[model samples]
Target: MDQSMASDLIGDLISCGNIDHAMVDGNKRPFICLELEDVSGNKLRNITLWSDYAQQLNDALGDRQNLGHVVIILQFMKHKIYKRKPAVSSMFGVTKLFINADIPDTHTFTKLLIENRGSEGDDHHVTHLTTFSSYSIKNDFLNNLQKVTINDIRDIVKPMSCVVVATVKKIEREADWWYLACVKCNHAAKQESVSEKDEYGVVVKKRSIFRCTNK
Candidate 1:
């Protein structure tokens, strides 16, 4: 499919994934390995980039510290997994994932700021203006902030859309599932249930409730 067509179908085609690893090979090629799950939650998928595509992703990463919000177009091909806990080769099908790493303009940022500022207490408001503002600042400023605080900021900013910013404080892994803690209450809420297990053979039990920590 054409890039524009792919962009239009992103909501339906591309699934959201967590960045399990971002590695740069000896050749200095950047690769983003994602742990993506579909709506059905059938299995976790891996997405990878090779050659020049790697360089592009690396450049984009340099522009933005986090890849959670950045949108990219990917052409996927299915591959069979013969073993459980499949390796990267098994998880990521052979496909071309394309990305256009252009930063949002000032006007777009301003609109996001206004929308988030207006929806201060609304549950539906999910934009993280504060973190966006912080990210917009120079790296030197980020250096001054504590590592924990920076992680907190990124967590808050990553999953948010243009309209809403969902800040995740703590994550709990339960029997084959994962839950995110409420930013307001720090309470664990069931987000997703997975079938993966730890090395110790313990079934992870994820929490189902999340509340704002402020309350």
Candidate 2:
């Protein structure tokens, strides 16, 4: 959808980033920044939920862990031009929010999300209980990609994980298949070459490096 839509934005959408929590320095008000993306994994970065609306959805989600399976519906969003680029933001208290609510739209989207993973999603008890484990893995896949295909592995891409269904046709054993992962997390560690130079610009020592940007 265009960021500069004249009407509200209601779609099969999900959050693309961690819910941010911080206090506005001036007034010291809590606010959340919900990074949004459509069902096709297209990011809607221009869509900004204002502090009021952001707080509304943040409170509705309850346990932040439920973010993985949430499908957000914004009833009446607004559009504007910020910094010369088209942008969207909430209309103060006018916009309505829904997260995995038991409405027809939510049910339809929940069904689609589950089927994308080749699974039956019609668990009456689970659905009624709102235990949307049905979309956790599938939505994680949607988080990074619009579709899942084992063939996409050959394409040079950023390091990320997604759920995919594929037959284990063959295992290549000619070389090492294991890789080094971060001890603190499951993320694969990236290797880099490091070189140290003497004060006179002479090469002294070399080493392989692994570092975290956010650390």
Predicted model with the maximum TM-score:
2
lDDT of each: 0.38, 0.58
lDDT, candidate 2, 156-175, per-residue tens: 37767665666798899898
RMSD of 1: 23.2
TM-score of each: 0.26, 0.42
| Residue 27 in model 2: lDDT | 55
By lDDT, the best candidate is 2
Residue pairs in collision within model 2: none
